[model samples]
Target: MEARPRVAGIVLAAGKSTRMGRPKQLLPFRGRTVLECVVDNALASRLHRVVVVLGHEAEAVMPLLGHRCVTTVVNPLYGEGQSSSLKAGLGAMTEETDAALFLLGDQPLVTADTINLLIAAFADFPSPIVIPTFEGHRGNPVLFSRETFPRIEALSGDRGARGLFREYGDDIRSIDVRTPAILFDLDTEEDYLRLLREFPAV
Candidate 1:
């Protein structure tokens, strides 16, 4: 088989986090803010590039990111919804990148190894979409092939790539990962506190 093209790591950090009251991406987690942890983890992965879509206090988050070997894309239309940020990030991808590993900023527990596993699965079996499922529940940081880029770019409203996956079910491939971290995301202050208390710092 031909060598699979490289993939970009797209981290969506443009949500308002209304439930958390503050930008959940900037919330402290294990000493570092949530967005920092997510970006650091993505940088550690073997992705072609790491793109962060920032908005909803983009200035604050941008400074925290500093000079990392990652590309930052600001989503001015972030207020529109998550789909806007997703499209912006995907738009920044290079043609060399055949796919993208989409991650959420609030998912601080998702490890680089989990991301690598997903990428490896995609390389072995090229699919339009590669999703990770634990037990019976499916979760985020989904992998999307370039084939679905058009549909993803055309997405609107509050819905995300999930809608695209459902629309193209025949092209979706799933891997049964045993890790539950895929399902863990810090959406509120209580959620963050619970995660800190349960997992602690490494």
Candidate 2:
């Protein structure tokens, strides 16, 4: 029997959160920091390993992650953009990893089921890139096969794997999911409050 492809969950939690006037990763959500919730969801998924990228307020965020069972990497170039954090996470992935699922730190509402759905799709379809959508709108926590790692590593600045979506359009697999959690990311106070109102139980 063929072995299952290994996939790692790369939580991008290194953003500075300038708009929110604080580190969004440290925001309180469901009795935990936003990043903690995101990491918890990743841990509950079918991923083989979970790597969290931290920046901005790394010292403060470090405490929140003390007891977690995930690997953490500090991106010194985090001020450069999201891609820096992506690179940091990728650097932490083991050589055996077959794919990576990039989860946003501020998207605490994204459920483990949604992540498992993407993992399952990657296993069946084996697309170079797999993403989730809701009601025709694309969402976060996109997965990229190992074959695309070089291209992702070539990216710079604020651009991320999404920058290559058009180039790999034909090979991309877009799975439609039931919840809009994929579309929600906390960038401002209003966004955080709205998420709390909408996903109180999360």
Candidate 3:
């Protein structure tokens, strides 16, 4: 019998958040910082492991994750871009990892259900890429098969996971989802306010 693939979750929390000013990872949402919420949610998922990459204000942001069940690593090259954080997170994963789910630290609303849903799909129909989409719009927390990690590591600049979708072409897969939370990320003051106004109950 084929052994089950070990999937890991990688949270990119190292951005400078130049648009939001200060560190959005430390911003509060639902009684917790955005990084804490995101990491907690990822930890609640069925992934084999969860790794959080931090930079910028890593000192302030990391302690928030101290209580959570996650492995936090600081990306010294975080100033370069999201790709660097992605690389840093992947490096922290174990050799047995079969795929990695790349998540945003600012997207606290992306629930564990969504992460597990993607993992389930990838388990049943393994692919080079598994992206969550709302209606026709693509969203964050893309799952990359271990085969693509090398390609992703080679990526440079601020561009993150999305660019590889176009590069891989036919290898990409999609899991059509119902929630817009997959698209929500705290990138600015207005974005944070919108998150408050949009999902007040959560």
Query: TM-score of each candidate?
Result: 0.96, 0.97, 0.96
Task: List, residue by residue over 1-202, the lDDT tens digit for candidate 3.
Answer: 7766899999888888899987898877778777888888888889888998988988887778777778989999988988899999989988899999999888999999999999999999899999999998999889999999999889899988788888889888989988999988887899999987877754
Q: Residue by residue across 1-202, what tens digits does model 1's lDDT show?
A: 6875698999999999999988899888789998899999999988889999998999989988878988999999999998999899988988788999999999988888989889999999889999999997899789999988999988898889898866887778888887898999988789988988998888
Query: Which candidate has the top score in TM-score?
Result: 2
- Let me know the TM-score candidate 2 reaches against the reference structure: 0.97
Off by over 4 Å in 1: none
Q: Order the numbered candidates by lDDT, best leading.
A: 2, 1, 3
- The alpha-carbon lDDT assigned to residue 28 of candidate 3 equals 74
Model 3 TM:
0.96
How do the residues 1-202 of candidate 2 rate in per-residue lDDT, one tens digit apiece? Answer: 7788899999988888889998888877789888889999899989999998988889999888889889989999998988888888889987899999999888888889999999999998799999999999999989999998888898999998899899898999999999988998988899988978877862
Count of backbone clashes, every candidate in sequence: 0, 0, 0
Clashing pairs in 1: none
lDDT of each: 0.90, 0.90, 0.88
For candidate 3, give the lDDT: 0.88
